[model samples]
Target: MHPHDKGKDRLRKFVARSEPAHPKLPLVHSTDAYTFTDALEDGNLEPRDCDVFIGEALIYTFYGRPSYRPNMNESATSLDHYLPVCLILKLSFAQDLKRIFPFDTGAFANDYYSTFMHRRMGLGDFALEADLDTPGRVITTFFGSARNYLHAAPDTKTQFDPAQFEARSYAALIDAKNSNAMDSRGSGIEIQIADPISISNWVEAAVVPSTFVQSETGDALRRLNIEILPYNVHSRMKPNEYMSTVTDACLTYYAQKGML
Candidate 1:
C-alpha cells in the first residue's frame, strides 16, 4: 500500500475510535433558533437559547448535550453561550427540529438560522471578553481524547476493557465543544482555533513524543485538519497536568493489557 494510503487508514481508525456515539447521543445545550424566533415574532416571554433571535434575523443557534450532570467543575456559568455550531455542526444545523428533544417537547426548532449564523455571532461582545484559560472541561476532553488517540499505535486494535473510561473522556471533550455555557464562541464571532504555531507546538511537544505516535501523527493532522477549525476545537492543556494525567492513563492502558 502507498505510504499516504497507509496514513489515511491509520487516522480513519483513530477518529473512528473517539468520534462519540452517532445515535441519539444525549442532547444538551442545543436549541432550535427557528423555533425561538417564532416566539420573538409573536412576542412570547419564554427564554431563548442563544439570545439569538432578538434581532429581526436569527444569527445562530447554540446547542449542547449535557454530560456528567449540569454542574461539572469545568462547566462555565449557565447563561454563557457554550453550544456554538462549531462543536456539533449537524446537531446545531437545524432546518427545523420538527421535533423537540426526547421526552421534552416544550419547543421545536430548525437549523436555518444557526447555519448562517451561530448564536455566539449575536453576542460579539461576550466572545471578545472571555478569558483565555477557561477550564473548558469538555473541549479539553475532546482535545485530550484526540491527543490520546494520536498517541495510540496506528495498528493497535480497539480494546474493550477501557470502554467506559474512554466514553467519559470523549463525552467530556464533545460536551465542552457543544456546550454553549462554558465556551468562548458563545459570542457569535468567527473564532480561529489554534494558530499555526500553536498547532505545530502540539505535534512537536506531545504527539510526536508518544510511544505509539510516529510519522502518522503529522499525516493524520494533515488529513483531519482539526486544528484549523475553532468550533469543535480543543487545545493542548496544562503541560504539567496533562503530562501527569496521560502518564496515569497510559499506566492504566498497559495494565489493562497486562503489559506491565
Candidate 2:
C-alpha cells in the first residue's frame, strides 16, 4: 500500500505492527488475507493498531485486483464501506497510548504532537511498508474503477455493478471467495466478524440458548449453522478488539473526511 493512501502517520504505524509481534510476518502483502488473518491467531501476540490496518488492507486488496468490477458496490467510493474497520484500528492505537504513555493532554487532545519523542522510538512508532507486493493488476484495476466514477449512475461513484456484492452475509462472502476453507492441520483462514459487545459473552452464549439470550444469531453460531469461533485467535479479546476498533475508527476518520 502507498504511504499516501494509508490514513495517518500514527495510524499507519499501528498497521505495520507485526502480527503475533514475534514470528515476523515475512513482509506479506495486504492482499494475502487468509495467510495474514491466520497468523493473528497463531501465537503470543499483542498486536498494535497496524495489525487491524493490515486486516483492512487484506480485505481491500481484493478490491482492484484484476478487476475492481468484482469489488463494486452501491457506493462509488473505494473501500468506503471499510471505514468501520479503519476506525477500530485507530481506537486500539489510542488505547495503547493511554495505557503506556498515558496522555498528559486531556481526553480532547488530538494532535500527533501529543507524542514526546525520546532517544528511541516510543510505543506508537509503526512502519508503513506494504506487506505484500500488491500485484500491478490489482492496483491498476482498483484505480481504473475509481477513474470511471463520473461515468457511474446517479450517486454511484464506481462504474462496477454490485449485484453479487449486496444481500450477502459474511459467511456467504468468504465461501464465494473460497476463503472459508479450513485445514485440519490448523490451516486456512478464519474471518472473525461479529458484534464486539456481544463477544465477551461468546463462551457463555454457547451454553445459553438463544431463547435465554434472545439472539437467534447466537443460536445459529453455537450450533452447526456456522463456525462460532472462526479465525485462529484463541483470546476472545484479540478478535473482539480487532472487530470493534476497526469499525469505530474508520467511521470517524471518513466522517471527518466527508466534512473536509
Stretches of candidate 1 off by over 4 Å are 1-130, 135-195, 198-200, 204-260
Worst 10 residues of 2 by lDDT: 182-191
Q: Model 1, residue 56: displacement in angstroms?
A: 26
How close is every model to the real structure, measured as TM-score?
Answer: 0.17, 0.18
lDDT of 1 by residue, 79-127 (tens): 2222111112222222322111111111112321233233432212112
What count of clashes does model 2 give?
23
How would you encode candidate 2's per-residue C-alpha lDDT over 32-76 as one tens digit per residue?
122222322341112323333333322211111111111112233
| Candidate 1: residue 225 Cα off by (Å) | 19
TM-score of 2: 0.18
The C-alpha RMSD in Å for every predicted model, in order, reads: 22.6, 20.3
